[model samples]
Target: MRERRRLPRPAKLSVEGESDEFVRPMRRSWTCLARRLRAPPLTALRFLTPPSRRRQRCTPGAAMADVSERTLQLSVLVAFASGVLLGWQANRLRRRYLDWRKKRLQDKLAATQKKLDLA
Candidate 1:
């Protein structure tokens, strides 16, 4: 099996507008090679806040109306559309393969019956 290389986290501007709140990971020259292999860009941001120390700055209703929520919804819609297309193509390919196999088996059976009749 071909091994997939892990993508290095890209330099991100802090969501809270505090540069010192989050520290970037150390630079590794080897990660440059990993990027050249066409790996997907790392979009997930790792926040430094501990579970107990973290507080919800905005109300739940406000978060739902935020720009981030719209972006997330758009991403989800694109993913769902892509998944549906892929599944349809896969179902089509499976049906074609099954049909071809059925025809081949029927032909083989007919040939065997002819040989039996002649014997």
Candidate 2:
């Protein structure tokens, strides 16, 4: 009777009960863990959080356009001041360059006049 019961158990087994037995379950676990770990932070976060508590994703298109009037005025004032300072510096540099060029030309002319006088 025991032998007869054991004989029918082979047909009930899901597989042939061979070398493939341990492999399938382990492979399935590895694949599942790999997929879970490979998920992006935002995607994995969704699984860890409840729907009601899930944070809204920050979209690049959203902007904070509310600027204070005083900030605008200050920025404009700063820009104008910087422009004035820059213009003053540029004018000073141009004056110095012109003086240097004129001195160089006068020195060259003096040298030529001396050479002509000696000849």
Candidate 3:
């Protein structure tokens, strides 16, 4: 796969209101061992906080939303699937009813012809 490169930003203005400074790894020895790649512009502010605390202020669950964004997506998916199932079932029953009605009418027509011939 080809890797995408970002446009070089002007030195004066910071990208995404945050500068991509050289981030020091947790340990000095580890940094020397691994070849460091250039970091991307900090578009997401969450990275500024410690990894231990994502939603809260330097601590987990200090301030979190009651429902996550995923809940809305899941509800929408379930409703759409239910609608599709109901529609498919309705079409199947409608076809069966129409076929039965056509057969009944054909039988009635055949019975009438038999009586006419006897007369």
| Residues 4-60, model 1: lDDT tens digits | 766556565344655643543333444556567765556435455646867779998
Per candidate, the number of residue pairs that clash is 0, 0, 0
Q: Is candidate 1 or candidate 2 better by lDDT?
A: 1
After superposition, the stretches of candidate 1 with alpha carbons farther than 4 Å from their true spots are 1-67
Give the better candidate number (1 or 3) by TM-score: 1
When 1 and 2 are scored with TM-score, the better candidate is: 2
Q: What would the per-residue lDDT of candidate 2 be over residues 5-26, giving only the tens digit for each residue?
A: 2212233324465676755776
Tens-place lDDT per residue, model 3, 19-81, is: 445323223434443444546457654566655644544434543355477986888899999
TM-score of each: 0.44, 0.46, 0.43
Candidate 2 residue spans exceeding 4 A from truth = 1-65
| Clashing pairs in model 1, backbone N/Cα/C closer than 3 A | none
The TM-score measured for candidate 3 stands at 0.43
lDDT (Cα atoms) of all candidates against the true structure: 0.76, 0.73, 0.68
